[model samples]
Target chain A: MTDPSRLALVPFVSVADMMRLVHHIGLETVLTELAAEIEADFRRWESFDKTPRVASHSDVGVIELMPTSDGSFYGFKYVNGHPKNMKEGLQTVTAFGLLADVSTGYPVLLSEMTILTALRTAATSAMAAKHLAPKNATTLAIIGNGAQSEFQALAFKAVNGITEVRLYDIDRSATEKCARNLAGKGLTVVPCRSAEEAIEGAQIITTCTADKQYATILSDNMVGRGVHINAIGGDCPGKTELARAILDRSDIFVEYPPQTRVEGEIQQLDADHPVKELWQVITGAVPGRADADAITLFDGVGFAIEDFSALRYVHGRLRDSGHFLELDMIADPDEPRDLFGMLMRAG
Target chain B: MTDPSRLALVPFVSVADMMRLVHHIGLETVLTELAAEIEADFRRWESFDKTPRVASHSDVGVIELMPTSDGSFYGFKYVNGHPKNMKEGLQTVTAFGLLADVSTGYPVLLSEMTILTALRTAATSAMAAKHLAPKNATTLAIIGNGAQSEFQALAFKAVNGITEVRLYDIDRSATEKCARNLAGKGLTVVPCRSAEEAIEGAQIITTCTADKQYATILSDNMVGRGVHINAIGGDCPGKTELARAILDRSDIFVEYPPQTRVEGEIQQLDADHPVKELWQVITGAVPGRADADAITLFDGVGFAIEDFSALRYVHGRLRDSGHFLELDMIADPDEPRDLFGMLMRAG
Candidate 1:
């Protein structure tokens, strides 16, 4: 069999490679850079070909393909969400993504997106908080300290200048795990016993529970007037973290309304309820935090553009990090019309 | 860093591995088995989740994601079609696919689909012909002999008992390449100067061209009684191979009506144009090939179910074949909620 040409090879970053890349660039820097990339993409969001994620739902879970293109490049992520996976000692969400040149439709980069998704999700939240959170917000209350909690805490610390994180989860061990993971990470990690206790003196409250139903992680009265709410867990149709009353009290901002209305916490409200697009806020076309006394909500459902940004960012880092393997993924026969001949030669 | 667990590793079949596996299984046997698998899936078609491919179109080409699931397993293929790429010495289409567990929402296999797509497409065309073609059919005339022509010829020989293939292409060199590839493949290869001469004594006419715009490769007068038409190239909007008059004269069958109406040769007809689903015919709900003299047309805009069948078949052959690489594409921590801890330990 003949060796594949260079054009047929696609750079692939496995989980270990992604971890190495993250460490090589430093987590804080990665988070901050990812935030910057995402923000930059959001600034010119109209140039993108955006669509609501295409999701296939089964009885147990859902698998989705999130695809978006920005004229020059195309990107998509294959992600599955199964909340019951936790009990099976598996991640509730696992993903992989690809970036390709739009002109030729050839994949240039393929990366394990489980770690990248977590990073991008946190980075997006922190980026939004930078625009919506009250000034000098130093403390963050993270409700549901699970797999995503520490990343959220660290991202907020890096991007939004949060110096302390108060963690709480229904499962006590999860809180302890998050706290332990965040130890000596340049932030004060406080393990709180109750949801109210976690939000005691924090200006930003992040709800990231892993329930698959409409369970209210936070209620109307529990939320104060001057706090920024980062709702991340309420990502699918029947799953939401905040109560409808809490949504009514906050000025909600979302990634993409067509998608958020179907999958985010905004699903709890009326279909026509007014909400701001986060990109508009970033581009200075829409106001973020209206007043110091107003409640601000960033309902992030994790859009395709953020994943696109993350993959593009990783593709750029491949040159310096050298933490990728090239897989002979595309079949580039010497003669474009002789694919069968190529196979015959291999035989 | 600790080695990734078994759950994190996904088996990836590169183009070389796929080629070797195909040669190991024998190309003819692979085509026959793939046809049988696709036919079996077609028989139980209603049990699967079906959606038209999600396409992202650019000025030069298009990238598409085709996804489907059958309760137990979910599969998706990422493919691109760029007719202009041929001018730059690139294949018109390249693809990769993934199969995942529906229950856990985790990828089980990742295989290079560029070659597999060519194989599956040919297998599907031949499988459809097996049902719709006249009994004792022996000759296939393939128009626009490009990368797909040789595979079509071989698949017909393996699955439908075709003994001769007449090939024609606007570019005579493409026809020469195809004729050379199909040499000694247990079939008579005839290279023709015109589409008319190619179908002279052939029982089946396979139109597989690469032009992106609407251009009639076969007209009403070129088609005759009792011949089955396997329309393969008019797969996108504004790109068709057969004349509308020919479609009106034949008994048209389609894989998925909602999709074929928008992307097949039948797109030239009315929205309410009557067409039979190939699965219905395979399951015996609808009859195929009404009479010996009646022309039967299979307007196949390749569907997701066929790719699912192909991926499922490849996945089943992995155990003994062992023609795959284990990729650490999933982040499987010992504790499901300790992903951050896993990354920190990697550091």
Candidate 2:
């Protein structure tokens, strides 16, 4: 009967809009800025309320809700992981998220997180690497040339001054895809034929392959001393990429232990195994890369706080970018308690 | 960019769309249909994956995520309870929910739940009343005339056999507002000054006041034999409306025991107190309203399954109503692993 209230309109960033935003801001700048936002949130980790993602596991895949709040803003992501989906012309992981004002419980931004998750996951890895990688790391090896490979390459380049990227995947076409995408992106993109060749002369190694069950994309023999490993694919129970021997040799740093122990590559180890918490490292409570001679691993199973930070960052830029649609997502009656009156008036 | 894949566009029902759909199908029929949908889901309660909503409590309010799955479909509602928000010209509760194909982990429908929540809450209470209220009940008393008042009146009239409606509130203007809104809704609407006067000849009393702290809207002596008390507002800890003495006198039936113990009026009762689960009553596993003289109280602290059912109901009608908008909420690259290429192509 009347025009929808402005309070009811939530800003929604679609997948294409997210792409445009990244292009407008420059993906490298977005990555660098996202990493900074993530690092800031990590420094004040004590202020956040964390929980292991609530997952609904089915035979074919799993759908999960990752929610976190930092008093001022609240955010959550709906993500689904189905490794076999790629064969059906579907993504193995698809996501969307909402950022709401904690004070009023009204959604401020709703974004398609399938692209954003890739960006945040890469930024988080790059942030951890900045803390735990060897001094002046220059070259990176990406062992899985899948959906996340290019973003990881760019993030490392943007944040850590990496000059070269070496790529490898079980599927050669995937490696070509990654290599083709990285062409002319201001880095030496080397497409390697084997995982061993991919890691050759690289200081940082990132393994992100999609296989629902345990599969070693990186073995212990290949990982040398002083190299930082950003293991991303080993998220979700029973899905891991690094061999336990590789894990045993590396000084493991994790996002959230409770979640990492169940969903990260560290799920391969004993529950009580000693590992460094990355947030503590960022906050200076714990040492990162104590010595250059030891291998370090950042077991990054994506966390909700990263999504919160990503949403907060997007919400900040949405005002000027105009790359979003206003969604009629909330119910706002002229009188808060007159919802029925509003409904009756609709006729 | 190529046109968004059909799979990427999720149907979103806004508040206006929901009201239009409700009016399209008579409100009474929607209530009756929603009640049946809720009743059917309750009958097969074990089919759903259940968990108490994950809540983030702050100094001012609480934001929660209610998630559930019935094996085939997954649903979750992002709801915030901020009583202070109403004073700021915002709804005390504003919500939106998503229903996804659990098989693929992709969202199919997104609907504004603030209005839908009122519809479903009322339908759920009325459904329980149909099974637990005294036979030939006609008069209904609604205490705390707020956003939910008119829905309760109509739901009871549609689901159960109710004719006359009596309303009362601490603020008499709320009562007047509710009565005025129900003007031609096919019932005798009576606005009373006190809660006591409102329940004068009513067999069913619905108390739904919004208070962050415990306060008695209905005392012990006010409740008598053979009356069913639908306590809907004592949904969060410390926000109750009924006296402890009143809870002690009734056969308390609840949606879920663990949740009710923390959020329902039974929070005032012992942890080990024997209370009937509403699902059990609906499934005939437990008896409801054992006799006319036995007082029955439905401690309805809305649950995830009810939201799941409501989402399912809206999704079923979305195609025919054509009142929903399609938003590109998922990434659909031709090659699932070529997400980076999709972004580059968009540029």
True contacts kept of each: 0.94, 0.91
lDDT against the true structure, per candidate, is 0.95, 0.93
Q: Under CAPRI classification, how is model 1 graded? A: high
- Reference-based TM-score of each model: 0.99, 0.99
In the range A1-347, model 2's lDDT, one tens digit per residue, is 88889999999999999999999999999999999999999999999999999999999999999999999999999999998888888999999999999999999999999999999999999999999999999999999899999999999999999999999998999999999999999999999989999999999999999989989888789999899999998899999988899888889999999999999988889999899999999999999997988899999999999999999999999987989999888989999999998988897
Flag clash pairs in model 1: none
- For residues B219-271, could you state the per-residue lDDT of candidate 1 as single tens digits? 88999999999999999999999988999999999999999999999899999
The DockQ for candidate 1, computed on C-alphas, is: 0.93
Predicted chain B of candidate 2, TM-score versus the true chain B: 0.99
Worst 10 residues of 2 chain A by lDDT: A214-223
Q: Which stretches of candidate 1 lie over 4 Å from their true place?
A: none
Q: Give the TM-score of candidate 2.
A: 0.99
List DockQ for all candidates: 0.93, 0.89
Residue B87, candidate 2: alpha-carbon lDDT: 87
- What DockQ would candidate 2 receive versus the native complex? 0.89
How big is the positional error of residue B82 in model 1, measured in Å on the Cα after superposition?
0.6
Q: List all candidate RMSDs to the true structure.
A: 0.8, 1.0
